[model samples]
Target: RPAKKELIRSGIVRTAGRILSSAASTPAAAEKTMALLEKLSTCTEGRAAIGEDGECVREMVRRLMKCSGAATAHGISALWSVCCLARDAGAQAAAEEANGLTKVLLVMQSDCSEYTRRMCVELVKILRVKSTTSNLSPYHSRTTHITPY
Candidate 1:
């Protein structure tokens, strides 16, 4: 069981890294990458695989800033899955350090697809909850102040 899980994780992370590295040059490729991300979001091991790769998390966060439509939605969904399933402090810290929460807020306010908007909102809520409950704040503070426009 453990070996199979490791194999699956390794393959998914490698594929995600390849797609993310090359998908920036083409919209169709980006869309396909997002589709793969969304599919990966459906499973716990997949989410852990993505979270374990710092580069992958960073790339998805970057996509949140640059990509749109389905790609954007999938990126947000993937991050949400990581936040919920991985439950890893490093993953949450990476997202927070990358200003992912702020980007999600901006995306929520933009004229994105309904699915995108929904995922952004959900991601924000998840981050906020994690921050408050886990004391993940830099100051060990208890409150998370996210102002939405």
Candidate 2:
């Protein structure tokens, strides 16, 4: 029997949560989580359901980065993957720069997890390079660039 439309709609959040939990245990699942987060970040309607300012997305990384031992290592690596996407999008103005990256890095740098610290350093390095080129080109300089966001 086909599930009721309402039941299917109600199941979406649970399904996403399951995906996130599984991400912690498997590399393939973690990649899927990153992809799903990226899609959710782009969907205005979906984003609203999660929270204003994509807080849910941020929390996913936060949860992973805060885990202990081996789990923390994988979580931090997963977070680095997510942030790389955000950083790239931000450089092109395709994503909002509301200090999400900055805040996470601050926490990661002080994180008990060595992997988190390393990922934080890597993110900073990438951001430095991206920032250096962020304002280049005639359109950007002229303030007439129609940013994707």
Candidate 3:
């Protein structure tokens, strides 16, 4: 964990993000980079670094499906980190704009853990809610559930 922080301190996350978009980077390399990014996302500086790097967010969404199974999981976990854990609205919007919802749903149907699936569901719901609330109808405003207490 400390190693990850030190790497973040060294500003390597941007280089890692660049690797994600480079054609010369192999699948194994990409996976390793993603795993590192996923681990780094646990820290505030890491999440901030990811959010600050426009390529990091866009390339993550761009390479969502092209990577291997573990890479996909790590990528999704990284996305969940910045978008959900850090509550980054811009990242959420970028994911939504890139049609990451379909990708998230597809990954949810795969062999990932329930926690990851829950993250996928939350990402979908959060983006959906944000998109809908912009032009909310009366029914959307009213609570579907009612209680007398």
Candidate 4:
């Protein structure tokens, strides 16, 4: 049997390709695949679900955003779905670091598409809401809207 890292890497690659292709081929299937990808976007081996090579994930998301059809909505929604999972696994640090996750969210906020902007705002809210605590509440409240994304 291969190491878990190998298995995960394979899955990541497979999912990335599926997400890209699904952007055009099948919105329903794409949504489902995106869900799985989001699930995989959890902490693993002291790293993030999206892993160090987030370029692939980011690119896929960028491509999805580039789409101007119904598919784009599904893809953006799918990305949002994963942000919750990522927040859960990686915690505040995940949101703060984790390979430009915040940057992507900010970019989505400014997306020409209204749906994408709404989705990005929602994702930021989710991260802030989920991670807020007595000690961090003030910090989050003050910086939530001003962070890079």
Candidate 5:
């Protein structure tokens, strides 16, 4: 008799993607999604999976701009994970295209938690390093100036 093959269900990344897709309109749902994102940030495969979804990355950046407290901190952690894991130019380009740099800067100046502010600072440094290495300007071409918080 042939050995039975194990069935695989949707992975954490897939579930997180679904949660993030619906999180925009609901605050409770956003909180849950951010928690998942924070957990995902601890693993390289999870980070890569999140980065592969352009919509997810855009939504995370949007959350960074709008969400407060733990949600904002989770968004920063998730973005940091993506930046650390993403070796491709497309990932960096997608982040820049989504106006992530300016949003992150804004978060830095906001009265968010100290952890959130530190994460934003780290994210800004990562983006600057990536931009310099890629030979692109630190700010995206479309982002002329970042408004003060």
Candidate 6:
């Protein structure tokens, strides 16, 4: 955990945002970056640092299903840290604006650990409520019937 603090002290979270946004970032590189991000997100300062950068949040959202299982797990965990754990509404909005909810749903349907799937579900709840379209949480009464507007 000390290493996470050291990395945060070195401003690696900001650098990480740039790396994730770079086109040169490969899947492996993204995975490693997400891993580091998840580690840093364990603390309050780290979550604030990450949540401050909309691009970082956006990139994490973009990485949802764009890499390996490790990468996906790291990405979701980091997002959960900033969005749910920290309860940063701005980060939640940034995520939704980046189409994070859709990617998270896709990830949940894929092969992933139950922990990650649960995190994705929580992220979905936050992102949906924070969406620009509505500020209320989604409720489904198990009705599968679709109604045309």
Q: Give all candidates' CA lDDT scores.
A: 0.69, 0.45, 0.79, 0.49, 0.66, 0.87
Candidate 3 — number of clashing residue pairs?
0
lDDT of 3: 0.79
Expressed as tens digits, the lDDT of each residue in 33-55 for candidate 6 is 99989988989889998888888
How do the residues 1-149 of candidate 1 rate in per-residue lDDT, one tens digit apiece?
A: 46536655568666776677674457667667777876776777777777777777766776675765677777877787787556656667677666777778878887787866776766776666545333333444445596787
**Best candidate according to TM-score:** 6
Candidate 1, number of clashes: 0
- Cα error of candidate 2 at position 42, Å: 21
Model 3 misplaced regions, further than 4 Å:
130-149
Query: What's model 1's TM-score?
Result: 0.70
Judge candidate 1 at residue 26 and give its lDDT.
71
Stretches > 4 Å off in candidate 1: 1-10, 22-24, 113-115, 126-149
Report how far residue 108 has shifted in candidate 3, in Å: 1.7
Candidate 3, residue 54: lDDT: 66
Better of 3 and 5 by TM-score: 3
Pairs with backbone N, CA or C atoms under 3 Å apart (clashes), candidate 4: 42-49
Candidate 4 whole-model C-alpha lDDT, 0 to 1: 0.49
- lDDT of candidate 3 over 1-149, digit per residue (tens): 78877888898888987998899999899999888888889898898888777678777877766788888888888998998889887777777666676778788888887877888877766666655333321234335467886
**What's each prediction's TM-score?**
0.70, 0.34, 0.79, 0.38, 0.69, 0.86
How far residue 3's Cα lies from its native spot in candidate 5, in Å, is 23
- Ordered list by TM-score, greatest first: 6, 3, 1, 5, 4, 2
Model 3 clashing residue pairs (backbone): none
Candidate 4 residue 138 Cα shift, in angstroms, is: 12
Is 1 or 6 the stronger prediction by TM-score?
6
Where is model 5 more than 4 Å wrong at Cα?
A: 1-11, 85-89, 129-149
Most accurate candidate by lDDT:
6
Candidates in order: C-alpha RMSD to true structure: 5.8, 12.0, 5.1, 9.3, 7.6, 3.8
